[model samples]
Target: MRRLFCLIVLYLLIGGAPVVAADWSLAAYWAKNSPDRMIDILRGLNPEMRSSYLNAMALNYRFHQGRRIHWEVEAQLVRHHGMQDHWESNAVLVARWMDFPWDRWLDTRFAFGQGFSYAWEVPPLEPRSDPEDGESAQLLNYLLMELEFAPPAPDSQWSGMIRLHHRSGVFGTFSGVEGGSNFIGLGVRYRF
Candidate 1:
C-alpha cells in the first residue's frame, strides 16, 4: 500500500506541472479603423494612378504546438479619394519570433504574413473621368514588428502595443504597379 501511494503521488506531481501556452490577443489599430488612408492620399495626388491603402487589425489566436505559429482573421476597410468606402477581410498565417525581454515590462515580437484582399468600388459618375487602373485583385505581403508593454499585474493580461507595419500592393496594375505604406500605430491588447 505504501509503494502504491508513492507511485500515485509521483504521477500526480508530474502530470500537474504547469504548462505555459502561447497567449493570444486581439490587435487593433491606434488611429483608424481601416488601411485606406495612404491609398486615398496617393489617389488624391494623381487620380489617374490606382492607389489604395487598406488598414486592418486582427484577433490573433496562437497555439504553442512546438514553435509559435499564429492564426489570424482580420476585418479591414479601404477608402480612396473620390471613391466609396470598401470592406475587406483576410485570413493570415503568421510566424512569430519573440525577442528577449527588456527589463520586466517589455516584450518585442516580429511577425510576417501573406494575405489577399477583395474590394468593390462604387462606380464614379463618369467612369472615364477616373481611368481604371486595370488590376482588380492583388496579393499582400507584410512584415510587422511590435513592441509591447506587458505589465506584471492581474496575471499579465493588459498590454500596450506599438507596431510598425509595411504593406505592399497599394498601387494597382498600371502606372508602375508597386507601392506600400509605412504605419506607426499604438493600441491596447488583452491576452487570454
Candidate 2:
C-alpha cells in the first residue's frame, strides 16, 4: 500500500511538471485546531477549541482548465506552533468550481482536494479516535475544502480564502487509526 502511494505521488509530480512551468498559484493560511470531529465542527456543535495551530504555504499547479471546472495539484509545507510543534507536508489533487451567478460582484470559487499527508513527528493532537485500537502515525491521508473570493476585475490575481485542513486515517485505512485531526484556517491565494 505504501509503495503504491509513493508511485502515485511520483506520477503526479512528473506528469504535471510541464504544466507547472506555464501558470501556478501560491496559497498560505493560518489554521487553528478544533477538538471535535470534522462533521460535528462543520455543523457548529463545537464550542471549545484546542491549543494547536499551524501556518502553511502551498504551491499549486493547474494542469487542466475547462470552461467551469479546473484541475490542480499542490504541494504544501507546514509549521505547527502553539500546542503542537512539528513540520508537515502533503501533495494533493484538487478540483475547483469557478463559475458562479454572482461573478460580477465577487468572483467565487470552491475547491475540494484529497491526497497524502506526512508529519515530521506523530502530531500531538491526532490521537486515534478509538484509543483501544489504534495510534497516530507520521503519515496519513489529507483532505482540504476551500472557499475563495476575489474582486470582479478579470486582471485580479489576489483572493481571500477560508479552508478546512484535515488529516485522517480514512476509517483505519492508513494504519489501525481512525479519525485524526482538523484545523479551521483563513488564508490568501495569489495566481500568476
Count the clashes in each prediction: 6, 0
What lDDT score goes with residue 73 in model 2? 94
Q: 117-160 in candidate 2: lDDT tens per residue?
A: 99999987888455764678988999999999999999899999
What is the Cα-based lDDT of residue 75 in candidate 2?
A: 100
- Stretches of candidate 2 exceeding 4 Å from the true structure: 1-21, 45-47, 128-130
| lDDT value, candidate 2, whole model | 0.87
In angstroms, the error of model 2 at 59 is 0.2
What TM-score quantifies how close candidate 2 is to the native fold? 0.86
Give, for candidate 1, the lowest lDDT window spanning 10 residues.
121-130
lDDT (CA) per prediction: 0.47, 0.87
Candidate 1: regions farther than 4 A off: 1-23, 31-55, 65-84, 101-103, 120-139, 170-176
